[model samples]
Target chain A: MDVIAGLGQGFLVALDPINLLYCFIGVFIGTLVGVLPGIGPVSAMSLLLPVTLSGTPESGIIMMAGIYYGSMYGGSTTAVLVNIPGEAASVVTCIDGHEMAKRGRAGPALGIAALGSFVAGTFSIVALMLVAPALSRVAVAFGPPEYFSLMVLGLSILSFLTQGSMAKALLMAAVGVVIGLIGLDQINAMPRLTFDRLELVDGIGLIPVVMGLFGVAEILTNIEQQIRRDIVQSRIGSLWPSKEDLKASAGPVARGTVLGFLLGILPGGGAVISSFASYAIEKKLSRTPERFGKGAIEGVAGPESANNAAAGGAFIPLMTLGIPPNVVMALLLGAFVIHGLQPGPLMMSQNPQIFWGIVASMYVGNIMLLVLNMPLIGMWVQVLKAPYKILFPLILMFCIVGVFASGNAVFDVFVMIGTGVLGYLMRKFGYEAAPLVLAFVLGPMLENNLRKSLILSEGTFDIFVVRPISLVCLLIAAALLIAPLLPALRKKREKVALDATD
Target chain B: MMLRRAEFWGGLFWLAIGAFVAWQGWLLELGTLREPGSGFVFFWLGLIIVAFATSIAIGGLRGEGPLLGDLWRGARWRNVLLVVLALIAFGFMFERLGFVICSLALLLFLMTVVDPVRPTISIPVSLIAAVGVWYVLEKMLLVQLPKGTWVEDFIPF
Candidate 1:
């Protein structure tokens, strides 16, 4: 009854013309960036972070949220037609989606993808609506130790999931925390790393750092390589799938939705991982696994559904626990912070309008994506035809403009450049930036929680262990940290990474 | 061999950073456990970084990674260098030249020099984008953008 009432109130806010327009703009831009490979949601969100300052918090957050899930819908278009994953989440789609296109089944492939995404996207929103409230109630009981340990676990899970060297990922996480701590110390008024510069007094802005690392660094990396696009020339005959295709897709979509929602709730698990896992699971379950990568509609259906569902599920932590589960959520958290609103246990009660409005907007946005994607497939394909040589410069210009507009300071632009170079180098050296960015956002919170817990416990470390939630979190984190040292587990971790690349 | 290994150099760079951070933490004064100071976390993080850095450097020393040159082998590294230099120049001139002039120059340089899109497309696209963006930001969004501090006195808005 309460849920229905809250949703009723939520729709009242979402249906407002201003919010509706912002939602449309968000999903539209979301799809655009998702269709383009060089820029992802992280870059897009950071680039637009400053723009949010001009609107009501709900409008800004609704737009930011729209971009995320909307990208999940848009990514499959490129993956099916051009054999390039529009975004990282769509990487697996290329294997089967492109094959389906090559076999002159492009229409069915795209049709199923959109259908599966709609089903999954809608399911996840309902689930998020149901799950987030109960979870927030549980989160309300959490103390400083629990919060600290949970953050530690979140960082550990991210580091554990990172490809290549765990050591490098951990080091990056450490560096991120250090960078995050650069400004004024929250506990004490003293600045530890500011070096007496006035700019350092406030610390580095998240927008500049994010744009530098994801936006500028991506352009730098892409321009150094020769990019190729091969759009399918065959006619896309129909937008609806055949009866057989729909029958084949129904199970995978269902399974993918469930699996993605469960995984999405876990910190560090997100769209990319969910999609890959769904593909692997569907392949294992298929009667003829040999057809896994050969125009199988299940292959198209499952992963696409999973990524979209995961995107929705990812919100539970951020909206309830005030912890960003991944880099994209971290950016959303940045948006929330900029708007002077904290998204946590009390948010639903304290800011029910903002909370329910965002939830209601997702429903509206998902429908918008379906309507937009099915009819405008050709438009997205045309967008893909734009040359990279032309695109990169414009992208670079936006990066500069975005960074400058973010802080209105030239120093931030310089910071973006410095981090861009560093990010490019880190990529070459095999370090994942996701863990670093996540940690950078989590660092200050982690420090504050730890200090608060100490003050509460009179400096006894036992406080962390005495608390059941904290103990469990710490133990799990410890196991993940220690797992890489075990040879068998190490091989398993490597296999997962290898599978992702495949 | 260690010097040639990419991991060794990367690890070494982080190691210096770790040491510097630890030194900074120490300088900031580590309060006791009962009343944790600002630097307590920094100090521990620094040590943790140093530990990880040492392990990475040791991995490199054991001859277990790619060579340094292999990172840039057969790559268009010149493009990367040019782009970096261009961005640095943009950063320096952004406020001085203002958004319109600076963005136009950047778009032109990148399209022409860095990757070289034809001037026909480049000039028009550059002009439209720079002016369009400047108008959107300054007028529509009401966000103030620099109008070339050096030329602002001469220009009539």
Candidate 2:
């Protein structure tokens, strides 16, 4: 009854003319970024974090959330038409989607992707609505030790899942935490790594770091290589899938949605992993597995659905526990903080309007994306035609402007440049930045909880072990951290990484 | 051989950083575990970083990674160098020359020197983007941007 009533109230907030406008803007820009390479939701969200300040908190958050899921939908367009994944999650789509395009089935390939994404997106939102409330209730009972242990588990899982050496991932996470802790100490108000600089007193701004690492670094990486686009030149005939095509898609869509939602809830799992896993599962399950890379409709249906569902599912931890599971969600957390709102256990009870409004607005945004993607495919193809040479310069300019506007200081701009170069170097050395960014966001909260638990326990480490939740979390983290040491487990991890790369 | 490996140099860079962080933490004073001080987490994290970095360096020492030159073997590295230098120049001149001038100069340089887009597309696009963004941020959003410390008197808005 409470859920229904809250949803009823949420629709009222979401249907507001102004909020509807913001939702449209969000999804529109989201699709644009998703269609373009060298820019993803992380860069887009950080770039617009300051713009969110102009409106009411609900409106801003509604827009930001739209960009994330909308990107999942737009990404497949580029993958299917151009054979280039616009964003990471769409990489699997390029395998069969472009193949279908080459085989003169571009219309049906696109049609199924859109339909599958819509189904999965709607399903995940419904699940998020149901699951987030129950999860928040459980999260309310969590203590400092529990929070600390959970964060450790999150970091450990991320390190374990990252490609290449686990040591590099762990080191990056550690470096992130140290950078995060550079400002004045939260407990005693004593400066640790400030080096007597006033800007350091506030610590590094998330916008600069994110923009530098993601936005600027992306440009640097892309410019170092020649990027080619091979758009399927054949005219797309009809977008509506044939009855047989729809029949083949239904099962994959259903399976992908369920699998994606579950994976999306995991700390280290998201749309990218969900999509890849779904593709592998579909290929394995098919009796005629030989058709997977040869333009199978199931290939187009499954991963597209899974990634969209995962985008929705990734919201669970952030909305309910105030812990962002991925880099994109971390940026969302930054948005919430900038708005003077905290999204956690108390959010549903205290700020029901905001919570429900965001939920309701997603339903509207999903529909908007469907309309935008279907008949307007030509517009996106035109956008794809814009040369990288022209785009990179404009993107670089935006990076500078966005960073400078974020903090209204030149120091922040320099920070973006420095990190941009560092990020470029890290990429060359095969270091993944996801763990580092996630750890940076979690560092302060993790430190605070650890200190609080210690104070509560009178310096005894028993506080962590005695608590059941903390103990379980710590045990899981320990297992993950140790799993890479075993030869068999190490091989499996490498195989998963290789599959992802492939 | 180890010195030519990319991971070896990367690990060594982080190892030095980890040591420096640990030294800084010690200087800041590590409080008791019960009453943890500001540097307590930092000190422990620094040691963890050092340990992890050592393993990575060892992996490199055993020749388990790509050679440093291989990272940029076939790439257009000159474009990257130009972009980086251009960004640094923009940063130095941003406040003194103002947002519009700096942006226009940076965009034009990128399109021209780095990749060489035609003048017809580059000139108008740079002008519109620089002026249009300034209008939106300054006039519509009311966010203040640098209006040239030196050229504020000379430029007419």
Candidate 3:
């Protein structure tokens, strides 16, 4: 009942002319970024982040969120139409989506993906409106012990779920944590990794690390592979899904929404894992599992829904706790701070308008995205015609301007270049950049919570066990960390995956 | 032989980096707390990297695979060289020529050097992009850009 009222208030906020404008702009830019292969929302947002420093946090945060969710909506276009994934989340969509393209059903594959996404996105937002406040009530009571436990879970889940040997993932995760420790010590106001340079006082900036890893690393890898060979245009026939296609997708969308929402609330690998999980589940439930990698519409429907739901779900932890669940959310946190608003449980109590306003903005953004994306997808297809050579320099310049303007410092521009080089090296060596980006974003928070938790517990480590929420979170983390190790669990999981994919 | 060549070179590089970092670490005051000095982390990470490089060298020497023949497949060294040189030039030109000219030059060089293309099409496109972008960023959006001597008269009010 209360959720309805909150949503009404959100609508009031979102309907405001300025907020609406920002939402539209966010979706427009997001769609543009999402259509281009080798570039994603992270780079787009980072390039624009510094430019938004003048706006109220509400407008800024809403705009960025619009971009994030909007990109999710647009990410599948290239995957289905062009056989290239614009983002990692869209990779699974490519398996069946591209196959569907080759079968001359690209239009239906795309249409169903968009429709499933809209349904899932809207459902999840509604769920967010209802579940967020209740969760916030619980989160408001969290202590440092709980926060620390949550972070540990975050690190462990991120380390374990990534494909490849757990040892390598753990090694990368460790490197990320250590790199994150580079700035300053959260406790006692002492610096741990700064070596005399005055700019080192604030440690390394976030935009640089993120842009370097996801953006520059991508450029390096893509350049190394010369993959721009012309692909034959798949016949893009009807824009509407067939009756059977709709029937097949309906159940997957529903299941994906529920599953994605649940996973999104967790600490790490929320959206990425949810998409993978949804694809796996859809294949398992299908009577024609063999149809999956060979142009199955259900494959695209499930994961697309799941990923959107996961995006919506991510807002829960961020709003409920001051802690951000991922790098994107962390950047949102920075925006919130800039806007003179602090997001946490008390956020609702202090500024209902801003809280409900942002919530309402999501509703507005999702609708704008669906409307904008469906009709203009043809225009988006044209975007693929632009060559990477022409685009690369523009990207580099955007990075420079963005980093420099963030604090109005040239120093950060240097940071962007330095991180770009490091990121390039990492890609060459087969080290993943995402964990490092996540670590850079989460490092300070982890440190702050650990030190604060220790202080709150009066140096007694047992406090982490006393709290039920923290204990449960820790247990989840332990399970995730150990899951890859247990031979039974490993075999079962793989069998489950292979069987589902069969 | 390719992995060996890479690894031998990598080992030498890491060895150099590690020694340099360790030497630098000694100069930084440790502050006596043993909580790990600012330099300590880098020193140790570098040493570990060097050790890993050594192992890679040994593995490569064992010739686990045809490293030489397999080296350049899908490898695009030209792209790296283009980007690296362009960036160094861009970095230096940033303060001197300002963002507009530097970015334009970078865009031009990148299109020409990184990915080979027909210059007849690329040149005019690059110029228009450079000038068009300059107008949008500086004239329309009101971002202050570096004023180059030649473009002082071209600066849009």
Local accuracy of candidate 2 as per-residue lDDT tens digits, A101-157: 999999999999999999999999999999999999999999999999989988898
Misplaced by over 4 Å in model 2 are none
- In terms of lDDT, the poorest run of 10 residues in model 1 chain B is B148-157
lDDT of 1 by residue, A1-502 (tens): 2789889999999999999999999999999999998889998998898999999999999999999998888899999999999899999999999999999999999989899999999999999999889999999999999999999999999999888999999999999999999989997778779988889888898888888888888888887888988999999879799999999999999999998888888898888889989999999999989998889999999999999999999999999999999999999999999999999999999999999999999999999999999999999989999999999888888888888888899999999999999999998998889988999999999999999999999999999999999999999999999999999999999999999877
* lDDT score for residue A466 of model 1: 96
CA lDDT of each candidate?
0.92, 0.92, 0.74
Interface RMSD of each: 0.8, 0.8, 4.9
lDDT per residue, candidate 3, A245-361, as tens digits?
999889999998899888887766667779888988888898989988999888999999998899888888888887677767767776777677788889988888888888889
Between candidates 1 and 3, name the one with more favorable TM-score. 1
Candidate 1, which segments miss by more than 4 Å at Cα? none
Which RMSD does model 1 reach against the true structure?
Answer: 0.9
- What is the TM-score of candidate 3? 0.88
Model 3: DockQ score: 0.26
Clashing pairs in 1: none
